[model samples]
Target: MTTIDKAPTVQSQRAGTGTRGTRILGTLTIVSMVWLIAFGLGFSPADRDQQEAVRIMYVHVPTIWIAYLAFVVTAVASGFYLFKKSLGWDRLAGASAEVGTVFVALTLIVGALWGRLTWGVFWQWDARLTTTALLFVTYVGYLAVRRLGGTHEQRARRSAVIGLLAVLLIPLVHWSVRLWRSLHQEATVLDPDGDIDMDGLMLFSLFVGVIAFTLFYVWLMLHRTRVMAMEDMMEDRGLDEALASRRREAAMPDSEEN
Candidate 1:
């Protein structure tokens, strides 16, 4: 009797950036967000001055905080990339910058809504607003610099420089209210005098917002960095294939002449 050859089973890989850790993190993020919504909207009492409009602070504050954190991470990672000449650090810097840009936009939008309610105008020439807008624009330019065409090293070097320089705006933006006579309120949670201006429950809700957003940031960074890595791999592979194709074509002309 003739034995038939057995076909080997090929394991199929799942597509997408998620992993077991990210899934667990995503679950935690979702749960924390639900709690944040409950505490921020339902449980926390309205501000005596701003009334229901104070609810926006729960989102507005955390978003700006995360944006600042993301920029700092980008600056640190960019520094490491410059020192170590490592692509991993470069990928991290790019991912963080992208995520930070989104958070900055969110912060501006939420702040505008809060401003409209409290300051009686959606837009203002306040120092805090101007500096925040400048911060957002600077990062947007940093991202554009990253996309400028060149080798990976070229892209990383230029972008890293911009990343390092762009973070200088954060301190200026943070202190703009203090440094100038402005309509923007001083920091309540991070009061310079160490006095907590918010109620107990309100403070707790703000903390919850911070925690939820931080978790979300980690989850997003995980997915984004993985995606960036995959993109680089694809780009390198395509370049190699194109070079091989060129070699084959160059040899074909000689073979045809022969």
Candidate 2:
């Protein structure tokens, strides 16, 4: 297989740079998260029933939002790869898939913690739990396929196709509780009968947490892409392979020299 001799320049608008705007956005994210985490920990009161256990929301809700955002990234990257076939898109897709897995795992952990506190059980295999678990497993498979399957482009193309199809789970998760009544609650954002009833500071903190976690997600994806690119560079340039080939050639006496 022919490897690309040079590293591809990764450029995506979602990727932040050293520009002042990016710096300011990053700084704002840090400030917001610091305040949100602090406020959620200290200022926010425990739920009337669940008490301190409800406090887990500070960590849980933000992580779930990040997971959703990650799926969005995966969908976009897969679509881009299908249309443009940019190696960058494939790299981003693969990176996002890994990150998404982390967040999905977090979601499961936090959800179980909350379930234990409120329902007095560690887990219940409810509709929400089962569907979300299925979603996580599906993407984990997506990542494994790329790692264990064919060469770079081939694996990427295959993963992209799988990713696009796997994304159907997102909508299913959103509707699972509606389709089947369960212990897990429906989304607070769009309840049909009433508006979201979050307390003032709590709501503000939650929104800020979303922003903070999304920024964190972007930071992770960029770092992941950079690592993948460096690996690609080493494989493509074949510096060691070329050296080994040269050594092999040297071991044989040249007929002309003789």
Candidate 3:
């Protein structure tokens, strides 16, 4: 009797997608988050006008900043995927969009909570809020387009186009307050005159939030892209095995009747 030896599968060879660099980044993110919470919720002084409601800025501002950054990355990666026809770029774009969508949703939720406290309303059709909602919906659609039934290249091509077009809304959302009348205040940190209209401690805490969220975003991207790569590998392997099985069955000889 002959014995067959089976090779190890991709999953069997690896435990997870994490790496040393990602582990370090994850650690840094956790530390920064702890610091941000301490300062944002405990140390930072309340606004004379907005009072305790201003504390929400730490989370609200950082979330939108990360969301914008993620969307911009998705657009850039999508362009590269279109030009180079590389699956790596496509995976990056998809992962970025997914992360951006989560941040945008968080931004909306936090913004609404802040609004309820400051404006005594949970929602309004203000320019900034409306445009932001549009931005969120647009990226959600982009993510959906990525999952449409088709070949990988086909999906990537369509998604890349949407990713590029969707990012154009970001500028409009950011400047919506200046572009039209709105209940939302103009930029306090990113003022056009390069002046920051925030208390020193509040500003510091906001910056800390930005750094922490950015690190978290990088960590998520690293793991998400690796998972995407593994999924692609498994899919290709399955197809190849199926084809080989069909070929072996076709090559078998028929038995003769007695």
lDDT for every model? 0.81, 0.72, 0.80
Candidate 2 Cα misplacement greater than 4 A, ranges: 1-30, 169-195, 239-258
> Model 1, range 72-168, lDDT digits (tens) per residue?
8899999998999877788889988899999999989988887788777787755666777888888999999999978888988999998988777
RMSD of 1: 9.2
Write down the TM-score of every candidate: 0.80, 0.75, 0.81
Q: What does the lDDT read for residue 211 in candidate 3?
A: 95
Model 3, 133-179: lDDT tens digits are 88888898999999996777888899999888876766766686446
**Candidates 1 and 2, the one with greater TM-score:** 1
Q: Clash number for every model? A: 0, 0, 0
lDDT of 1 at 125: 59
For candidate 2, the per-residue lDDT at 10 reads 40
> How does residue 139 of candidate 3 score in lDDT?
92
Summarize candidate 2's per-residue lDDT along 115-150 as a digit string, tens digits: 776676677655667677878988898888788755
lDDT ranking, high to low? 1, 3, 2
Off-target runs (Cα >4 Å) in candidate 3 are 1-12, 168-196, 241-258
